[model samples]
Target: MHDHDREALAMFIDYQRAQNLAATTIANRRSILTTFARTTGTLVDCDPFTLRRYIGRDARITAGTRRTERGALTAFYTFLHDEGLRADNPALKLPVIRVPKGKPRPFTAEQIDTLLASGAYTRTRAMILLGYYQGFRVSSIAAVHGHDIDLVSQRIRTVVKGRKEVWFPLHPMIAELAATMPNDGYWFPARGGRAGHILPSSVTNLITRAKKRAEIAERKLTPHSLRHAFATDLLEEGVDIRVVQELLAHEHLSTTQIYTQVSEQRKDAGIRTLAARDIPTSSGRGAASIAA
Candidate 1:
């Protein structure tokens, strides 16, 4: 690679670190920049056409992956432009890849009951219950410590994206479990000498095992599925979308609005409501014939 390209890429990565971006984000940016340097030989030589060609060459990747690549390149080029290393940000012109959104696959109430009664360990059951009731992400759930729960106030504190701590009321079931937990240390302690609470993968594995035991492994439920169920259930019960968004800790209202799509059960209930409506009695002979 050209020395200028190498130096520019290194500087860009350092800038990302200074911005306190996540390690995963930095690593992904580094990988994308390195690939660009390898393919185009130098950042100085790249333009919109070069970047577009590189992105289009990888047809096997999903639209989501393409979007990530585009974002990384856009940010990198913007950095270079800001530093006076380039005349323009070529990546600015890159077209966004639009991916179709799929309806969330949440667990049915009966399935949730069966999964809860599937003979899992107490801690595992508690974890599942928390996810379903609170709509917490797996990482947020794993990071939960005993002190985060306030039994007196019936509140549980959790950190969401952007490292913001949010407190919400605890469900009665989760609160009951919390009452028996130790005062200090992780409520769901990590296994095998790991530090802090359990890893998200461990939570996922726990859900998988419980799913198998419940004979619903075929349903392909994950911890996040419970979270989806939580939001969807609240929406079905006439909870406002904004309220559901807050409960789920969603940053955008649009993200929470996806749950408003009517489920099969909700659709059937709507039909049933229409069917149950009473027709007024008519006094005319034709009305009697129609009724008969």
Candidate 2:
């Protein structure tokens, strides 16, 4: 990054810190802005044309990546404009990148059972449960401390995406495990004292290894997939969507609603299967059956 970009990014980083964003979120914003500055000439001087052109340059970039880049750039330019660094926000006029509405891919029940039943170390199993049952982000799981677990109240506190501290009812197994963990430090403490806790990536690596041992096909199964399972499992059992939303700590109902589609899709699949075996789907019975 150029000197101008560095200074601007430093200031923006501080601003993000002031808003109490999670460290990962701040780092991502910095990375996105820095990459944009390095690829283009100057951060402060980029107009709408350059901004859009840069993002559109990569044919392999997924719609999700484009959306993330757009969000970061927009946030950066908006900060610059708000602080009087620029007369106008260049990002304001950048064309809206339409992101496809994709369904959440929750892990199947057998996948969950297989992973949980794997003879992994206790730590790995705990991390998996924290995701699959507790619905914590991997980052949140990484930051788990004995302080976050309260055996007295039967609740565990988690630092979520926005650095929001939320306490949820603790699982008995998690509470029992907490009793045996170090009370003075993080459960997943850094081995080398590089930081307070292990990086979230480390937690992910452990889970991946466990998944491999379970002989599950190495697809895009991730910690987030465990969280998806947590939500989907509840919804499948006819739990209220709003209650699941609260458990997932989703900020918007729309975000939680995607899991509903998962349930609907399963029902559709069953209908199609039945129609295939018993009734011809070509007779429109499948469609009518699904609609009704």
Candidate 3:
């Protein structure tokens, strides 16, 4: 029976939960493990070479993703060893790639203005607000079934993937609009139920179309840029980094520190202002004129 194999997978998932692994991380590993178990019909000994060959099949996956796969496989084997199914963890010999560092690309104020102005009503408004004002992922915004909004409180109760529930306060105008959003449908309703949901793909398409219409440059203009712009905007407004981190629900302070780089631009603007101010002109003839 594959029942024993299924039980092993369940125990591994349970262990991950106990360790406080994020929902996104657990879900991904679950998918990978299920795939492996189904393909092999058992949870047996797996070596580094076999795992490498499995991941090498996916061209679009990054080095980080491959590393995650390795970690998941190693955990599974460790579990098997503890249960006396295997004595050696073969994946201990595998080498994983290092993660690359990159800065986030943020949208300019002008581009944000253009994007907001491009959309007509609900969909456009909701999307723009979600990205800029609320710092919501496209998936979270799209998952906003009607009940999640609390218009009177001016907040949306969002169940963030791999994170705890967060309440996002709306901008005054967005709050007003949200009050009028349909009671039995999506906030950005082109759909019907919780299951009748919008995909991130659709949201991307909408942003692309809107960008073309607004004559905004397509390069580095993505749905996630809205979140970047939101963080940048908060920093420029003199909001503290820790505060922004809480608002974004970021678990790490380092993740929130990226906004500090954006805050430095504001300091530069202040320097430019100081340079632009005209100093009062001094009269060289003042002492002589007073004596006369």
Clashing pairs in 2: none
Point out where model 1 deviates above 4 Å: 1-14, 22-50, 57-60, 84-88, 117-119, 191-194, 212-220, 275-292
Q: Evaluated with lDDT, which candidate comes out highest?
A: 2
Assess the local accuracy of residue 33 in candidate 2 as a C-alpha lDDT between 0 and 100. 83
- From the highest TM-score down, the ranking of the candidates is 2, 1, 3
Whole-model lDDT values for every prediction = 0.84, 0.86, 0.74
Per-candidate TM-score against the hidden true structure: 0.76, 0.85, 0.68
**Model 2 TM-score, all chains together:** 0.85
Model 3 misplaced stretches (Cα beyond 4 Å): 1-27, 30-45, 50-63, 66-87, 119-121, 188-196, 208-219, 270-292
Candidate 3 residue 94 Cα shift, in angstroms, is: 3.4
Candidate 1 lDDT by residue in tens digits, 115-175? 8899998888888888898888888777788889988998999987766789988889888
Worst 10 residues of 1 by lDDT: 274-283
Look at candidate 1 and tell me the lDDT of residue 151.
86
By lDDT: ranked, best first: 2, 1, 3
Candidate 1 has which clashing residue pairs, if any?
none
Model 1 global lDDT (CA atoms, 0 to 1)? 0.84
Best-fitting candidate, scored by TM-score: 2
TM-score of 1: 0.76
